[model samples]
Target: MPVVFIHGVATRAGEQYQRGVAAREELIRRLLVDRMAASDPRWAGMQVVSPYWGDLAVRHYWAQATLPPVGTLEDMGVGDDGVAAADLEVADLVKEIGNDATGLEALGAETPLRNAWSKNPHRTVEALLAPIVHSDRSVLRPQDLGITEQARPAQALGEIDGRVLAAGSLAASDEAVGAAIRDALSDDAALTVITDAIVARTEQVAPVEASTDSALESLGPGWLDTLRDRVGEVLNRAKSAPARVATLAALDRYRDGLHGHLTLFMGDVFVYLLRRGEAGSPGPIVERVREAIADAPRSRADEPLIVLTHSMGGNIFYDLVTTYEPSLKVDLWVSAGGQVGQFEEMKLFKASTVVDPPAPPMPPKVAALGGRVRTWLNIYDPADILSFLVEPVFTDPDAGVRIKDLKFKSGVSALKAHGAYYSRPTFYELLGREFGSRP
Candidate 1:
């Protein structure tokens, strides 16, 4: 089975603000693809597809404008407090026009023509030229198009964390340290000895002086105590040499695990769409996944399907499998920082009328998929605030395999939350158990 990758909200192609940003995103994609190909020779045959879906751009002007919001058809005119009834009506009409254009796009119209028609040029031109002195201006200048900066790459990638590391400049010292660690791991020393060496080296590097001594001095004695406490916490955590070694090993495995044309499917929370009860309605999202999966090169049909989904992506996968090939087996389904067990809260059927008539539920656990789903592993980071603390609401622990939740002291960062599992070594180790054995 071919793996399919999906990006989270507000991250899509042709939706960038700056051309430079788009280049960077393309760079990230290249890096990921290259890294995966290098991990396994088979990965060279893997097909990678990034579907481009436009995201809504929220602007201050849109928030402050005297127009009714876009989603509703209600009419409210321009006013000091809010849009007037007439303005609201105009906004609604504009939205209707945009929707019509979107419908055309869905039916295969090119983007430029779709966007042009969607703008309702007559109304927009009237509004813009209204300030001009000319009573009859037939020609509109290109500058009058009111084009703003497109979305940028920085907005899509967000910030980096331990897992979702960005391809950018790093602190020279940090780079050197990381390089040294990698070098040490490359040696065939026993895991224990290698770990001890790393720990000793880390301890030898004394803490650097704060850049702002004056700022430190301004703090009371209590501040120093707090700083000391934090330092102690770090030292204490460092003492767990065995665990740290395991973590390093895991990271190495993850790095080594990407082989053949692997597809990484990322999941997000229900909050992505902000739909109150639509988290479980897989219809809205599954079609994209199917399309992506179908687009992958079929040369490596026997290659294992490696799926890593977080939060709502879990349910989305369920819908995909059930709808397309309920009998289709997968190599692995890794759920990290997910809420898959909370099927009741998910209310999968209640969100959409189409989903209301539920299909016969599959066995609650991952094992029940039999040969169809080889292994379903759920990994949780203790520091992830959004993840469920307990097992999912589903029954049959055997069907759904649970692993020791890997605890990273740094916790999950903004870019790392939900989608970071694929980037982490621990995640790679789990994948290695299935895919890495070939090499």
Candidate 2:
């Protein structure tokens, strides 16, 4: 059977190849296997395929920037030391700049890889944009969109830490370091807006001499020239301000767009998915998905197309399948924490004949999906803010699209619930029963 997993944002090209991606797939395999009584063989050989579309967004912005690749901080001689020094620089900046004490406090409380976000996302945004404020207009321009990348604030802070490290002055005030970076990155239009807002608040903007004195001698002459050339390349990007505005808007669409930068679960997936066009906004990624899953083997007659989707992934598939409509028949659709429930109400999907009270569930003997699918199950955590009852919108007894909604109550908090359904045992058990692999 074709077991396709549609992933949400963040799983960018490089990111999808990381350890966490492998771990999730491994766990899914284990979950499928564990559902059987150690005797079933049907699901034993099943493989899960997750198509990563995160690179689309990165590709979209990079196409416009047209600058050469940015070598790592390690190559620049800044190295991994920036991670440790970044904390120190942040403390200094917070104390000196008087940016956002609440956001800083939240950052301190947050876990690693998840620290830069605040309880108030908008306020945190302000703090991140505070340092670059200058005159009526901030020194940071829309062109700086490229600098936000995967981790905007944290990455921006680390970039400043690199300058501090190269300066050979661990003792330099956070204010001085921020100012130095602002000046050095001035021509580099790809600079992050959050970084500027943060650095601008520092009391003093240090001159290049103040930070680069000793390091400049060891670095030789061409390094500064290369930096200048890169700056020019960044500024010369042909795309106008509208592109930048669209990019920022894209950043705000998925998971309220917070997952792209703040959360570990998502990345730049929305950046490309949100690019609008005459045809459709997600037309690009949707086409890419069609190509990836086009070759699933049809070796077994009993096997039907099986789709497991979560969060934004479900939305993507819903659009794809809905567009194809009655022509597309998914044998089994396993949706968790998805927005599939709202499609009809949003006018994205038109209801068929307004079947008064939704047709109630039928017996197993009645068959499902017009005898095409064994079941259509949706498992979700009640606390997950993203989850909703699909029965109201998806149930169509006439079309044989039966939606069975089940709640998984294991979540400790609303925020934590969105990602927990994947590992929920009840979810796996339901899958096993529906597949008839277990008693």
Candidate 3:
């Protein structure tokens, strides 16, 4: 089988882009190609072709002049000169804990699908970390647990320290930690234990409190008390202000990401829309995809063609196959986190000639693809703002076009969901089961 993957927008040409392409190729090799080969050797040599279009992406002439400055921690009213470092440390720790908690929640929720997708403990743990990290939970507190700080910190610290050490060991290789996470996901008892430990560590045995205690124990309460008195309440602000830190930090991050990413996103989309020339004179990006599809290798004289597109790539291909090359063969066209339906609804794409349903006939372009493209699987995430349902957009039953709109939980929030699809093994697993096993 020959697979062509057209990437989404905001993809700039760099080592990161190269890695993404390579990673997708490997994912297909392991999840789809390798599995298909197990059933039939003919698919043993499945070829994956990922074309680059990021180089032609939107560019800002004025650079920073056009974009507003991203606010620093100081600008967010985080200035206690003496404890600036401590405040940053607390903020970072709180963010990490929040992310871990969210990951644990996603794993717990998706246990069945995760287990079905992969048996490897390492892969399982990796799947846990696959979700987007944008959690902003309130700071875990000892009072909430109905325990005094003194009663739990000692024992809890030991247990939590052990878990941390185990996590740290995996940190060096990164693989070890993911395996532990995956193992924890499989067992509820284990997951609960990990969750409690994390909560305890965050609330009872926080580094801020630990350091304060250490100072008091070594230098005597008198000296520390004197120092605290000198610094006044500001000395304790970082410890008591984690909620503020986490909130402000999350806001800042969201603001920065939205501004930066939205620019390139809109830029690339507009660039493609404005520049995509007429049928005979296709744009550079369109030509790149067309050439890639044409050059895609087939194992046999007649192998089924699979074209997988993400984000704007889906829109580009939708126009390409519909108007430019109406007879192009696409056995399986999977549009994950795409806006093909939305663009058509907005009358943006070149092939948007169809009147909405109740008016019998489907759009010429859509009906054309319905006949040629054997399977039009539209995988979308409810959490993703960018992902839209095609079935609702193009609902012409007589057209013989059935676009499967699958609800895949790609990420936890809008910030992460759009980009989270490709990172998920579960996504690949679904693809493998859906079309990889077909004859």
Candidate 4:
């Protein structure tokens, strides 16, 4: 039972990117490395593996996609402004053609313009200049017109006059004559290039790898089921006193079934003497922990299988020991910043069928194992809000091992309660002494 660390919600894989701030990743790295170092002598040769779950990817995709554009407008600039201005002048020519329709009729000729420009001058201009303004080869900028930076105004005036003449050649019936004139005055190549560039940039920054199915499969067979069942059973037992007793009974039954590797059931998140259910099931969290454990090489039977869990992780470990791996005895059980002492839900135990009588202090589950299990050390920082400051909880009379609470100032001054127990040197020293290689 290698020390398995189960991160809290939103801290899993894929979700790492969603941490947003750099500090979060740093903190996680520090905690992980520190834990490994603390387990140095006991787990000196063991590996530390962090599962790359997909929570971060999901979070990033949802959050980044909705952001506003960040680049400057100049970055998208094209010389289309001159062409646009020329299109404006073409409308005047279209209007002249429309008004001359009556004169053309007198001359026995059909109206050259299709519609009256008087109704909408803007449309008339757009129709006459559309082609030339939209053409790829058209050079609508000051540079293309051979005009210096200082002579842009003069060049623009000259271009506008030329566009007006181009619009005049179209028949009155040609409603799009004005659009063609404007099209001749501007170059669309620059605009096209800019648009393509913007699209390419957008695609480049898009996120990749948004799921983590592969990561989960890295664990061995039947791992998921074992984890789920263990968590469910422990959570169910913690709900009632009788169920807690029943849970102990169930552990005993399982112990009798297995032959090799003895089992030691730890307490729920609450570290207090009371078997009250405080921390929830360890199922989901344990899945990752198990995966990491599976990554390590299996050892000899005598080698201690140490499990060091904190907060809710301790609860999960307890479930696994009693329900799933009864014969697989844990050599050392280290609980830090534990919340098992605060379990308020003992009613669930009364309703359980596992216990003969469903009330009062629940009986220990280890009795069924006939004392094969060894040491159980429960460590706590006084500042940890979740642990009991003055007392201990998980005492096994038959096993003669009492739950111990160790106190230290967690150095962290802000949230001076729960998390620091995992980071402090004293906790590390205790872990190293039990699990680290003995020199």
The best candidate in terms of lDDT: 3
* Cα lDDT of model 4 by residue, 143-248, tens digit: 4333344323232322222222222212222434334323332223222222233223223222212221122122233222232232223222211212122212
lDDT of 3 by residue, 198-276 (tens): 3332232223222112211322222222221222222134334344444446344456446877888999998998888
Output the worst ten-in-a-row residue range by lDDT, candidate 1.
130-139
Off by over 4 Å in 1: 9-44, 52-284, 344-371, 389-439
Alpha carbon RMSD to native, model 2 = 18.4
lDDT of 1: 0.34
TM-score of each: 0.39, 0.45, 0.62, 0.36
On a 0 to 100 scale, what is the lDDT of residue 83 in model 3?
29
The parts of candidate 3 lying over 4 Å away from their true place are 40-42, 74-124, 127-248, 354-366, 395-402, 435-439
RMSD of 3: 16.0
Residue 318 of model 1 has an lDDT of 55
Better of 2 and 4 by lDDT: 2
Segments of candidate 2 deviating more than 4 angstroms: 15-17, 33-44, 58-282, 298-301, 349-374, 398-401, 423-426, 433-439
Q: Model 4 misses residue 191 by how many Å? A: 58
